[model samples]
Target: MQLIDSRYIMASPEVVWAALLNPEVLKDCVPGCESMTGSAEDGFEAVVAQKVGPVSARFTGLVKLSDLDIGKGLTISGEGKGGPAGYAKGGAKVTLEPIEGGTRLSYEVEANVGGKIAQLGSRIIDSFAKKMADTFFERFQTAVEGPAEAEEGTDETQKKGWFKRLIS
Candidate 1:
């Protein structure tokens, strides 16, 4: 599956770029990420547990950052094995552009799966991939910008609605 998306984070490109390279921040942002270690220089080793469709598995993998352009962008790629359930591999091209208030974080992702998990069909897998992407970006935004809060002129209901759109 392939997907493209972007989000405006309420932080400078430098701050978001630093968070992207921090293992602790990434661990918190990634869904199902149980443990993550290493650095931007050596890459990271991670253990993740996730359920896609009816398949549940723990994936031990290595995630690497490459094609660096300093604070501008980079390419992230990783592959993991989930025993007999399946193997998953994907890569994303990420770019950061400074916008009016903060930065525009954009990504193009491509993913593939195999083994028994592939039997679930494209409909299920595609939806799962899209959800994963959305959830990751949402969490990333939150991590970089902190929790959502009502703007000066916004009411409680407006804040609630904005938060709802963020996570959903």
Candidate 2:
């Protein structure tokens, strides 16, 4: 499946980029993330638990970022194994463009799934995927956008993962 979407952040592009690469922020924003170990340099090993239709499973995966351009965005790719549930892998291209009030963050992801989950059909999988993406972006926007202003010049806008699409 392929998904593309965009959101406007209230913070500067630099702030958004930092949050995107931050494992802590990702762990909190990711839907089912349990733990993330590693950094942007070596990639992160993570565990995420999720439920799809009648299947619920814990997925272990590795996420890595490449082709990074500071204060912009990068390409993310990863794979996950969910035992009998299934396996998923995918890549995404994210870009940040400066807008009038903030940054326009856009992403395009293409993912492939196999095993029991894939057998459920694309319609089901696609619907679930879209929902997951919507939730993620909504939370991300809340985190980085802060309120109406940055108090004391501190942006507290509150903000997840590479294989997220794979699981959905």
Best by lDDT: 1
lDDT of 1 by residue, 78-158 (tens): 998999999999988999999997899999999999998899999999999899889888888887776757668866422
Residue 151 CA error for candidate 1 (Å)? 6.9
How many clashes (backbone N, Cα, C below 3 Å) per candidate? 0, 4
The TM-score of candidate 2 is 0.84
In model 1, the runs with Cα more than 4 Å from the true position are 151-168
lDDT of every predicted structure (CA atoms): 0.86, 0.78
Checking candidate 2 for backbone clashes, the offending pairs are 143-157, 143-158, 143-159, 146-157
Considering every candidate listed, which one attains the maximal TM-score?
1
**Residue 73 C-alpha lDDT in model 1:** 98
lDDT of 2 by residue, 58-121 (tens): 8899989998998888987878899999987877788999998778999887878888989889
Model 1 weakest lDDT span, ten residues long: 157-166
- Each prediction's TM-score versus the true structure: 0.89, 0.84
